[model samples]
Target: MTADATKRLCDVVLDETIGRATPDVEHERAVAIFDLLEENSFAPVGHDKGPYKLALSLVDSKLVFSITGEKGEPVATHILSLTPFRRIVKDYFMICESYYEAIRSSSPSQIEAIDMGRRGVHNEGSQTLKDRLEGKIDIDFDTARRLFTLVCVLHWRG
Candidate 1:
C-alpha cells in the first residue's frame, strides 16, 4: 500500500452490463480487483477525494471510469475510446492462448518463451492505459497493469 491512503481505491465495481464471464475470466477479474484493492495509487486529478471507489464499464465502444468517494459521492468520470486498444487487446489474447496451450503441452523452455511474450503484451497494454489516463487520473505502473487486466476482462465475451 502507498503511504497516502487518500490515493488508494477502496472498492471496485464492474457494470452489470459486463454480464457473465467465463470461469477463467471471472477468476482473472476477481484477482485483479483483489490485488488492486490491496495496493494501488489512484487519485482523480483536481479532486481532493480519498479512498475512492471505481465503476468500470464499456459503453458505445468507450471505456468509462466512474470514480466516487468512499460514501459513493461522485468524484470524476473519464471516458476513453477503445479504438487505440483494439489491436493491442487482440494481440494480447492471442498471446495468452498460445501461453495456455504451451503450458499444457510444450516443454518448459518453450512455455517460458511464450509466457515472456504474453507478459510483453500485457506491459504494452499497461503503458497504453497509462498514456490514455495521463491527466485524468494519476496511477502508478502497477496500478495501470491491474487496470489493464480489468480492461481485458471487459473485452472477454465468453
Candidate 2:
C-alpha cells in the first residue's frame, strides 16, 4: 500500500470511534488495507488471489500478510512496520486464544464473534474488535483450536 493509504488506515484504527464501528461499514479501511497489500508487491510463489490462502512474514521489524491464488501464487501482499503495534502483541495473542477456544467448542456464536473481531482488527476502522471479543460469553474448543493455529501463523515473526 502507498504510504498515504497506510497512514489513513492507521489513523482510523487509532481513532477513538473504532469501538463504535463495524467491519462491514468500513469500506475505506478495507480499501486502504488492500491497497497496502497490493503496493507491497509480495505475491505468493506460484499462485494468484482466488483460493483464500494467506501467508504472513515478518522481517526486520516489518510484517507482511499475503493472499494466494488458486495454484498457490500470491495475488496481494500487505506490509507494515511492527514498531507501532508492538505494544499490542499480548492483546493480539489473547484474542487469538479466545478465538481458538470458541472454535473448539463448536459454538457458532463464538466462531461468529471471533470472525467479527478478526475483521475489526484487520479492517482498521473497527475499534469494537476488541470489545466484541471481550464480550464473548462462551467458548468452542474446536473452533478455538483452528483459529489459534491461523492466528499463530499470522503473528509469527520469523
lDDT of each: 0.90, 0.41
Q: Encode model 1's per-residue lDDT on 16-82: one tens digit a residue.
A: 8667788987888888799889899999988766899999887888878999999999999999898
Q: Positional deviation of 138 in candidate 2, in angstroms?
A: 41
Put down candidate 2 lDDT per residue, 1-158, tens digits, no spaces: 33332111111011221222354435434454444334332222343233234444556666454444545554556554555444345456566678888888867977998878765454331222222323221112322233333333334333
TM-score of each: 0.93, 0.31
Candidate 2 TM-score to native: 0.31
Flag regions of model 1 displaced more than 4 Å: none
Cα lDDT for residue 65, candidate 2: 47
> Against the correct fold, how does model 1 do in TM-score?
0.93
